[model samples]
Target: MSAPMPTGVHYHQRSRELALTYDINGESQSFRLGAEMLRVYSPSAEVRGHSPEQAVLQTGMKYVGLKNITPVGNYALKLHFDDGHDSGLYTYAYLWEMIENRELWWDDYLHELKKANASREPLGIPLQRQ
Candidate 1:
């Protein structure tokens, strides 16, 4: 059976990160998600669905960066990527999973990018305005 959903909610915001905590039917839960991590793992159809082959391989995203984060209700969020993508609505359940399995996800991302000879860091990177 799946673990119960979260109840009480708390978000710990840092200068460049956000950590969340909650209780699900009395089960305590938590996740610490970095802005870069969130940007890389967005679950929009652009990143996830429309067929596995149709999935765009995100490269040079290490420099893409986060422009801003918008709330999409209590359970989701809308992220504006520095590359100009702002369509994904990431749910808490998904973010929680990403946080819980961060190592695996990160490994997979790197592996895929490497298989395509892609670089995580961009070339000719442009500076962002502070």
Candidate 2:
């Protein structure tokens, strides 16, 4: 089954959120997605790596922001993050999955952090380094 088409998409820089609206079964649904969530869960090879076993744990992205959003044909979005990551192609289906499973995914991320002894703080912060 294909994902529903997004009726609208908006990025609020001040709030660091991506607002997406979709029409599902004639009902309009909206999601407010955080920039950090998008960055850490990026579908790019840089984050996902060549295989699942090689997936990179993304830390220090607490303050990451979107630099640009570009359409990839009619299927996906190319997100340019403020942290200099521009390789992710976020498909509509993937985005919808992320929205629906956000809580579970967040829990997994937190678990990964705990396993790695990593902090979500922005990179290069003096306090976070300690």
Whose TM-score is greatest here? Answer: 2
- Tens digits of per-residue lDDT for model 2, 1-130: 5787688989998888999998888899889889999999999888999899989999988777888999888889888998799988999999989988999999999899989999898656533220
Query: Which runs of model 2 end up more than 4 angstroms from their true locations?
Result: 126-130
Candidate 1: residue 119 lDDT (0-100): 81
**Worst 10-residue lDDT window, candidate 2:** 121-130
Deviation from native of the Cα of residue 13 in model 2, angstroms: 1.0
Assess each prediction's global lDDT (C-alpha) against the native: 0.69, 0.88
What TM-score would every model get versus the actual structure? 0.74, 0.91
Instruction: Enumerate residue pairs that collide in model 2.
Output: none
Error of 1 at 45 (Å): 1.7
- Candidate RMSDs in Å, in order, are 3.3, 3.5
